[model samples]
Target: MPDYYISQISHTDKTVIQGVTALLNAEGIRLDANLDYTCGMYDDEMNIIATGSCFGNTLRCLAVSSEHQGEGLMNQIISHLIEVQFERGNTHLFLYTKCSSAKFFGDLGFYEIARIDEQIVFMENRRTGFKNYLKKLEESSALQLQTLTKDTSANTATLQSDNALPDTSTADRKIAALVMNANPFTLGHQYLVEKAARENDLLHLFIVSEDASLVPFKVRKQLVMEGTAHLDNICYHDSGPYIISNATFPSYFQKDENAVIESHAMLDLTVFTEIAQTLGINRRYVGEEPTSLVTGIYNNIMSEKLPENGIECIIVPRKTDGKKAISASTVRQAIKDNDVDTLKKLVPESTLRYFESKEAKEVIERIRNSGNVIHY
Candidate 1:
């Protein structure tokens, strides 16, 4: 047998795992083997010197005992875990570490994607092939340096001498704004996004990625990404539970009447104001739609409230046919009726192809037959 070997540990071995847990704790790292999908690196004596865990498909945690720090133990642990994750059909891996360790991971196969705080750095690895991974790390670091320079320049431009927003700079900032349930992205949504992108420096699309939505949040987010893959400065982010719940948008789920809708709108306005402040956004972009009373009310409230919060709201007019406005509801209706022509008109060719390939017609048929016309 090799002097150093990496293998999966069974749950029956939990008692022995306490050694690794203690080591991690001593290093100021927390590990819940029961919750986190864990792996470990043990010495010849079977004492774990290094341990790591995967949170989701994306995030991972790695900690090595300080006593064994200067050795190649950390590299072995990470390399072994990466190989295991790849074998298990994971294509991407992510981790968060102190900013001081950014160069350390970057020396490995990781590339920083974002920063959560002043201290933590979020890194990702997307390469599966060993040779490709090395090449990608080099290319990614170069690109990251360029991006960082541009980002710093942009940040400086947005800030005054005291690092506060000046009164003059507030009016020129444009934001792309939209509410996405992501039930199914239609051509109308794409049109709205294209138009919004043209007018805004940054697009902040609010995806209602909550459990209440019929389509799973991840799937919806994926659809949004697929639909808007071509746009620049367009980014996707979750609205979180607070913005999607009945407490914020009761009208979305039809839980409340006009009064609740108004209240919910007020909450959404407040939440969005805070979001804008955090993101350095000053202008909001919306799509034009006249059919839904809830949307009408939302637009009306936003028009009044956003300006008060120092955000200028701009509503983009929807693309129109000779007489009718394009909408997701119309596409859903066409899908129900098996009206291919109308569905084609309402959805982008790529989006229509995806649904058709997935046999979504059957699902739409069932929904129509059930007579449940609820929007999700």
Candidate 2:
């Protein structure tokens, strides 16, 4: 056993970073280039022995050299990444790892959220996220649920309940749902909502409650509410931390991490499926995305997973302006380039009204200055 030290790596440390990638690749784990921060452990010989990377609060690409395995190097790397995230102001954390490494992290206080069989597993440091969120949501509807708690070994979690329970039934309405970011509430969003609302007796429009977008959740929610004011059957609600949240939305830095996109989508869709059953929602409508990489993958996942979970996912063709699809990204780009004519066509008139207001003027300015915005 030789002395080992761990430290953060920079772009200049290309050799060490490459070594880290090699170590991970050798272990059948692909290095996610989308990592915002990276760190590595070095032996006394200055040889990289272990490494890991962090994408916001979600840790990824963690690996240890074969020679260094079983020496607890993986724990050290995970600890470093967790501390980095904490210093960067992230309290909750998510990690995706190969099935074999699940227990290694599970011992470090990570709890399983979802798993793709033997392929991959998504875990969170906060064991109660889904249970707590579900409890809160069901509580809002006055429905009681048994809460889940981490087991004593921290190896797994189990569900628990008090002696009391709320009514577990909901109205048997012909209900559907749609989750949207509505970054600026474009007409495409309005069209999708209208179609869903027309067919279903009630439509639950979930706005991504995380302020993870260029536009804050409050402003985005307001625009969505105003734009859909005509839909009497539609109900707008915040997505909260459970659905498409920081834990699951993987386009962490305005770019796609293609490898983990589906994994992230699974966690979101899983929670959504649970919520659907609770609200008597049978179908979910989403505008087909033709441009954005992240949302397109999410829609595809919705098409595949939701039905299997007993929820129908309807992918509506996005409303097009001539040959082009209307998108929040297009609206943001138009605003950035000051293309008023094109921006007006993409977004609804109500959304445009906000673009002219003093408050939105500032938002638009920040958006224009911000580089590479993700369209939820």
Candidate 3:
């Protein structure tokens, strides 16, 4: 029989400490108890066959003896540790493991946050209720991955459209539509794209690249691509990490509209217009969603600035599902509640599967147990 328990290390547990030390040394993970940590293990007839530890807020050390491997013991221990961390208010959980372990935790909602010295993979899991922010991170990561593996075929489509642009000789005729932190690429975004594509022969879809959110930008961009793959006329490109996000548009988070307008709205308009001009883009497309105060400012700015810069502003109306406006928040709520029926109504089946595969149920369960009142 196997027994599992989690406990803090004390001076008396020298045998347990030595066993954990041996495992950590073998795995090349440094064990430091002074840091916030916990150890989980399975004891079978006085022998410790499996052991793992949570190192501070950043690292998860796990190892199992060869004899007891493949029994799914590691997963149970890891899940337990994660729950403990959540209870302790550790929102960001990190782990450094060999590349071989990638698929294991990836399935459990941990994603590669960074690569250390090209050897160890750093992974992290972000706590929920910051779903929008996490979605932004996923979009940015997808953009980076896409950039590293640039698809020439994807670029060819843009070039073909560029060739058809009116007065190609004029440098300002080509304009790209930018979407900074477009979390899930909602139908409103699709409406914006459609409006832009109708006006411009080539619509450059600039997905923001940043890690300010939990989903990892790469996954978010993939969702966008999958959602918009049928649109051959638009070109998908990353805005890189510097140009878009809260860092660039700090006013987006402000409670007051004027502060957001003065800071974020104006800054984004100026930045996009400058970049568009540099790239021979002469127009931009924006969706009219006044639900967000920041978005309302963006709409106002585009209406005012684009005309002055001789850039066309195309504002598409808010896409709605019956009376309610389609938003990422709504989809996230549906996911948290395990309302798959409502999710299907909100997103495409592919997107629905993406959320399902992310173990959104686990995320929702975490939310419910966190004792935080979730409005959705």
TM-score leader = 2
Which residue runs does candidate 3 get wrong by more than 4 Å? 1-174, 251-257, 358-376
The Cα RMSD in angstroms, rounded to one decimal, for candidate 3 relative to the true structure is 15.4
Residue lDDT tens for model 2, 1-376:
6788888888567777778768777776666655778888888888888888887668877888888799988888888888889999998988777678799889999998776666566688998886777666556543112221112123322111111121224455457888887777998988888888777655777888876678888899999999987654555567865575643444322223664576677767776778887767799888887676767888888899888987888889889988788888888888888899998888888999999888897788888898865455
Candidate whose lDDT is highest = 2
lDDT of 1: 0.62
Comparison by lDDT, 1 against 3, better one:
1
Candidate models: Cα lDDT each:
0.62, 0.74, 0.59
Which tens-of-lDDT digit does each residue in 1-376 have in candidate 1?
A: 2375665655457775676668766875555422335677777888777776654443344678787887877787788777777777876766657577778888888876444334455466743332343344335434543443454456665433322222323556565566667466777778877776666655667778664443456656777778887663555666643343442221211223665456556656765665666556687877767876777787789899899988888887777655688776666677667788887777776677766776455555554675644452
Give the TM-score comparing model 1 with the true structure, all chains together: 0.52
Global local distance difference test of model 3: 0.59
What's the true lDDT of residue 302 in model 1?
87
Tens digits of per-residue lDDT, candidate 3, 189-217, equal 66566666666655677877764443457
Candidate 3 displacement at residue 2 in angstroms: 62
Location of the lowest summed lDDT over 10 successive residues in candidate 3: 246-255
Rank by lDDT, descending?
2, 1, 3
